[model samples]
Target chain A: MAEETSPRGPERRRGDALLRAIHEAALAELAEVGLGQLSMEGIARRAATAKTVLYRRWSTPHELLVDALHQAHPVEVPTPSADDLRTDLVAALKLLTDWMGTPAAGAVLAVMTERHRYPELAEALYSRVFDPRGGTFTSTVLRHYANAGTLDPRRLTPIVTQIGEALVFKLTLDLNRLPTDEELVAIVDEALLPALGFPLG
Target chain B: MAEETSPRGPERRRGDALLRAIHEAALAELAEVGLGQLSMEGIARRAATAKTVLYRRWSTPHELLVDALHQAHPVEVPTPSADDLRTDLVAALKLLTDWMGTPAAGAVLAVMTERHRYPELAEALYSRVFDPRGGTFTSTVLRHYANAGTLDPRRLTPIVTQIGEALVFKLTLDLNRLPTDEELVAIVDEALLPALGFPLG
Candidate 1:
């Protein structure tokens, strides 16, 4: 009865709100400044919270940033209707492209660089970042076609599925920009579809 | 005769020797401590030279690293005799994989993160790192097969040629290791060959 009636309930709500704010601020900081420049005090400043509040939750900025990436993202790629493999693949990869244009891209890129030094973070990234984020989703889409004999089974491995992501990274690395609509179409029609044994419509 | 006998001859040789030493030391430093942590001062320390010496040559550490990647490397992929596309593609990609397995990979990876910030560097990378190194060779190989009507002309574009590179990065990012020869063979025989039209032997 005391738990239900307690004023502490409001405090709990406030704490949740503060954590949400912190997550947003932390990711924003990571994107703008990168990991080497990230600091707990900076995150706190951005979140409009006290440094003590941050330390109470995370021992270091790295801990906080990693936690933020693990949190559930609002992005939920609409399930492809399995109508056309080309349309389905383009839409799925395009969803991923939008995500890459935001702060999430920079944050993920910074953490990936640290992968060699932190194996634990790498595993966490596999489960929390890559799989849920896009890898598994895209693989399932490609695999569905492979299983149905619409796409060649050999062309449907996880690595093969990332042909779009590779083009995305190539744009990111080569031009330092996300794929243009023209580029996306080219990747889908000119490259990925044909590579997987499906040509243009 | 005066030009050849001038004391400036030894001075020129000495300068060349120091530049070679500096390039080696810079790449080693980049491999050991990535770009985020790299400093011209640290590179000078490792090279056993003055920071002033480095500054005289390069305006910044970024300049030095870029210059190092531009210097000629001993890698020369044997032209695949134009006999078998499979054999040629595998040999060309294999040469690239060998290059990635070296300290050069780390150096290049570090420089790439800076690409988003430096458009000029991006073009330099395209010409010096991507094109002269392997892109042109691989494209020519793929184009040969395409012209023969064996592989689709669509798969012969610069973007399509990156299929092998994408797989390489997938292996590197996901596994933190380069693909084994067997893996490369599978990639060529199982994936690339089929994607481009021709399948297993």
Candidate 2:
């Protein structure tokens, strides 16, 4: 225990801190000039670290962005409690908008554009980001309701899991702006819940 | 009857034919090179028509494209039959996918990118393209079902009208490709219909 804490423990903590700084810098730069114009030297200069460290860790900005996007917290999507359908949907969609609004709009666009040039990156984003965060939440929440007989068992399918996330992504990308709270509420109350067979009071 | 067959009537028919030729040329060119790089000269060359005619009718490619996007349709969205929600959603989504796949994707991107530079153009596309087609279909169809007691009356709202259209526009933009038939059916059956509270069985 003594040796564990004495030297390398503090060094490990410093290494993690440096990595965070580099990732933050990379995201900031991506938001500014976009993916095509991004440079390792520029990120290094902005990060105040050696260029060698960035090159060693990531051979390309695309690789670095895949890592950086994970840390950028567009917003946190939480698993639903056994709440009723309306409240559960509202809560889920709210998290989506929060994430949409968190990053600079340019940051998202840059990644979207890069995905066209790089298929592996697109697949990575789907696996790492899209699926884990929003995918399971809907199923878990809906299953809870289904078990209670609030929703039909057949309604608990892949479609239920994707509607809110798809809407948020679609609205943000199409409108080229994040939806306001009023818009989000209307989307949930007027559309999402009713479709899920949750008769609104 | 004699007046209907006058020389002027034949001239008007030719004029309409010319207009269609121009619109076709514009869409073809837009599909090839996209909105940004599209030129009147290029469209004229492709259509085997004169540049002066294009200039006289529509001064810019943007104006030409605005007209062309309206005409390039495999089918129009009709009011939903009371047959079932699954068929109605699939039909609506099919129309959406056709539109997305029509013009070269660059055409959509060009206009989307231009929305920031020209708010008036964005407003024009919304008023002319989006609202008339997808917007009205949802309300008209939902009201059709609701009147028959197949769907809840409250499900008839602007958000309900828009969810499938929103999802299609969003997926095409984000993925940079249109969804296939099987995927489209899955989206409609698995998600769209169920969300509207339509019983799957």
Computed on C-alphas against the true complex, the DockQ of each candidate is 0.28, 0.21
List model 2 lDDT by residue over A69-128, tens digit each. 766645554666635676776776776576555444456554564455556876776676
Q: Please report the candidate that would top lDDT against the real structure.
A: 1
Clashing residue pairs found in predicted model 2: A74-A99, A75-A99, A195-B195, A195-B196, A195-B197, A196-B195
Candidate 2 achieves a global lDDT of 0.65
State the displacement of the C-alpha of residue B196, model 2, in Å, after optimal TM-score superposition.
6.1
Q: Estimate, for each residue in A25-89, the C-alpha lDDT of model 1 and write its tens digit.
A: 99998766556568998898998788999999999887787778777355656476856887887
DockQ of 2: 0.21
lDDT (tens digit, per residue) of candidate 2 on B1-120: 365445464334357777777778877775555444578998888876788888888878778777765555334665686497667767667766765565533455556654654466
Question: What local lDDT does model 2 show for residue B7?
Answer: 46
Top-DockQ structure, candidate number: 1
